[model samples]
Target: MDNASSQINISFNFISDISNIDYKKKKDFSNVYNIQGMLNIRIENELFFSEEIALLEFYIQVKKWLSNKFDGSFYYNTIEVEGDDNPLIKFVASDNNYFISSPWGQDKVIAKAKAESLIESIKIFTEDFEEELYRTYKLNPKWYI
Candidate 1:
């Protein structure tokens, strides 16, 4: 590992509650579902950057990677800006009830590597989200690897 390298660890969560269901005939209060996780990545032989700037770069690469991998428009929910440094990246998939984090590293290549790791992690699931994407979008399954 290079001394100049940097690492970013991002943890995120997505939650949905059925509180909108006003049940007139039942006593049940509400139903909820939460999907959350964490990711840690390190970029070697690259320059070190602040956590905030690195996160922004990671997210930009994520959007690019997804667009290249799958066709059609994929939009993120939040790109919050704070303290006038740079815009922060946050992705929320309300339709699929997904909460995901952008990858971070010293450079674009490092950030991309982290994003690829995330895709590989998805392939390990029994109900693989990446597989579903392949089927739905008619994409090559090997791309995730």
Candidate 2:
């Protein structure tokens, strides 16, 4: 049997752009409408999965950003925010293959605020990583998108 956290490090590099629809928007018969509705539902599901993958990618990238900033060693599928009084930000893959929580906030702006807050509050810093990490703050979060 596979481990519970097996899905955490699993990347979805094969997902196609679900937004690239060939369908045209037009008035159609009721029956066609029903079929289109069903297809739309499927498309929505695909979009959801795509979003999930994107968010997960963002999380992983955040870890890399942290590592790059602090010159900290990187580990596979491991997340850590080191500080004696730092907020609890341990995110690991669960048995369900999803992260139990997000380190970043609901959106990019919130995520940036969270990062900034952590940087200011937490004393965890390495001489090598500090400069790089601070530079990341100047970058637009949209770059990750």
- Give Cα-based local distance difference scores for all models: 0.31, 0.26
**Clashing residue pairs in candidate 1, if any?**
none
Task: Summarize candidate 2's per-residue lDDT along 1-145 as a digit string, tens digits.
Answer: 5322211111222132324222243122211112111000011112111122222233334446565663432222322334441222222323222222323322211111122223322222222223432242232223232
- Per-residue C-alpha lDDT of model 1 across residues 1-145, encoded as one tens digit per residue: 3222123333322122234323352223121111112223323423322342222223334545464752322333223334432323333333222233333323523132233343443223213433433343333323322
Model 1: runs farther than 4 Å from truth? 1-12, 21-67, 70-86, 90-115, 118-145
Worst 10 residues of 1 by lDDT: 29-38
| Winner by lDDT | 1
Worst 10 residues of 2 by lDDT: 35-44
Task: Judge candidate 2 at residue 15 and give its lDDT.
Answer: 32
